[model samples]
Target: MNFERAIIIREKTRLEQLIERFNSKAQAKFYIERSGGDFNFYEIENEKFYESLNEVQKSISKHLKLKIIYRSFLPTYIFTENDLIVVLGQDGLVANTAKYVNGFPILGVNPDTERYDGILLKHTPSDMNNLIKEVVKGVFETKKVTMAKAELNDGQTLLAFNDFYIGADSHISSRYEIEFKGKKEKQSSSGIIVSTGAGSTGWLSSIFNMSHNIYGFNTIGENEHQSQINWEDEKLIFVVREPFLSKVTQTDIGFGVITKRQTLKIESNMPRKGIIFSDGIESDFLNFNSGSKVEIGIAEEKANLII
Candidate 1:
């Protein structure tokens, strides 16, 4: 196994400790970044985080020869060569796991064990030292995850670690007609969601009115109203256990499902005002006036995860 390119991804507070622990055993590097930007709130200042990172870098430079990098965004750099990676924070773990899928075994260290849902990491900060020792001793396992891919009408393609969403923009309703394999269905509701196995827990689960599963989709309509459904056995099944009625027409809202082989199409009158979000992060708004078509499908490339 190659041990010269060991990379450690962690938060500011735990950088020094991780570096000191792994530097002697393997060639190690560190990455640090500020948290809390996705929800439009700033948790830490850039200058403050960078200043602390610089101090940590200097301390590590005194004892080891390695590079210290900064991660400013999610889905950090892709893996080019085989290496042992030690991740130290929740965001770092999520970002690194989403980006690096090339059969590298990752050891996740939970800096804050009690606060967040560290289900993926599942290891305490105190366990970092032991985890590194185990990693060097070849004592661990890795898991694989699937990714959803989206291809637009313009031949542009994108990937999602969790799910791909096509829906109305914030505060605006969307009206579209759907076509599946030459069969047309007019949908005057919100939008559609296509998810992979890893994304089956969140939106998809809620839409189907069931617990987390392997693969599914969720279509959320306007005004917090939704019609949950799933595809199975060459047919789509809609769950109407707790049925809902449309407020505008007072008609029982129905769920929908389309076969996998069917070519599903969604065209909106307000396509420009509508939007498409992937994995709750990446997004692109459509322009109906320009007459663009948004196409989505299962991706050929799947994500590899170390669970």
Candidate 2:
């Protein structure tokens, strides 16, 4: 292969996580059983995922230089520009890895087709040879996935591949002042979800689904897939989940589109437990307390996924 190395990113399987917590497979099973969970399903899922991973590893070994990495180490890991990234897991794994890799050409490989409906994972292990051949010849097709950037006035920033959740860390309401397109409001809701085209089908889509599925909701002339934006779409959408209407708070500026020109600005009124987490990674979140301001917009950096 022309590339120096391919970084195969993966997540810890359910079984692995269970074993890590309990220290042994038998202990994990016992714990699951005691907790009224299905241990058999866990064992089967782990076995299938490992088997698929083995097949993928064997196929990728012949054509490319590969470096295997777990998802947990991604934040501290340094990725070179010349390296090719291959994430061997479900769509969430692909989204998690995309934010860290900058613009490296990432190939998403589905380890178990039956287990995961990986919309982001476009290739199977059997297709590895052709995919590698095209990449080495510099003839690969790429999707420039749009990403959402959350920047604090303090200079801290985080990129979201699927979407961004800006709100409270607890069950209580998130308090914030949201301004967009010269319109502003004091909102207290569950949170604000800023979604990119790439993320529309992810956490973003579920929001629409939940709203659309409401008994009397009507999406009359709108194409249902309109919320499922293309990967390269330049625009972004933000929704304030469950905005509470009261004397002090207004829902007028609750939802809108964030484009290349205009942006969404949020001022946090929460004293603590306020966070901005991307793609559902709760641990890797930014603290958004009182006096914190975040600007949400289209990120300059895009994810290049080899299709």
Candidate 3:
């Protein structure tokens, strides 16, 4: 496959967002300093990001036609097979870009090594030139990561690179009917989190941490076992958050594994405020109100990250 263009994906720096909100850089600085915040920190972060972004553009331009796009436009952006994706930001940016690319090879570039852990960002700006060349030659390696999918009965769907949160938008309890492996129950709880193998260490691991800290929690053994899932594993793990047991509800069917052969089904009972969001981006969500049923399973498509 001959790649013809490199699409650079980025997000606005914190300083930029602040400036937009305050109407000017000076005003933004004043607001932050007045609030005891380090105004210089935001300035430095913005400077370093643009500096790294400029270096990436220069290097990629030597190999393919380069185009820059803000992360906000990703939903409406049309990508072609001839495009190579270059994502510059923290690890979350890579996760945000993966679902929209349809398995296109993504090179994650860590703009600020000091600030971000960059678990998903394997390359730096200096590595772009050589990496782009290898990708264009089709000689590069990619780690195929499994993703989770939520398909509603009405045919609406959402993909999650890390995990999907199915519950109320607010802090109130979410009421739903959950079914897995022939067992079904009606419950009221915080929500349900369905995570892919790549997402095992993220929101899913935090749940395990909480469970570990709680004494006499028998679920610690199961949490430890599920946390070791690999990124390439074609499976998903679903856990019910704080499943409350009452005379009218059951908590027996709260946790399970999802696969090609098995799936977790959920039907919302909330009259309003029910939603399903993926990868921590609540803005891009599916309305999961009453009468909406969704099947949570392993997505057929995967995220192909350039390694």
Query: Can you list the residue pairs that collide in candidate 1?
Result: 272-286, 272-287, 272-288
Ranking by TM-score: 3, 2, 1
The superposed Cα distance between candidate 3 and the true structure at residue 9, in angstroms, equals 0.6
Candidate 3 lDDT, tens digit per residue, 212-283? 778545645654544658999888989999999999999998778898999999999999999999999999
Model 2 steric clash pairs: none
> All candidates' TM-scores?
0.58, 0.94, 0.97
Worst 10 residues of 2 by lDDT: 215-224
Best model number under TM-score: 3
Cα lDDT of candidate 3 equals 0.92
Where does model 2 exceed 4 Å of error?
A: 34-36, 215-219, 223-226
Clashes of 3: 0
Write down the TM-score for model 2: 0.94
RMSD vs true structure, all candidates: 11.1, 1.9, 1.6
Candidate number that wins on lDDT, 2 or 3: 3
Q: Count the backbone clashes (under 3 Å) in each candidate.
A: 3, 0, 0
Residue 112 C-alpha lDDT in model 2: 82
Give one digit per residue, the lDDT tens place, for model 2 in 83-110: 8888999898888898898778889998
TM-score of 1: 0.58
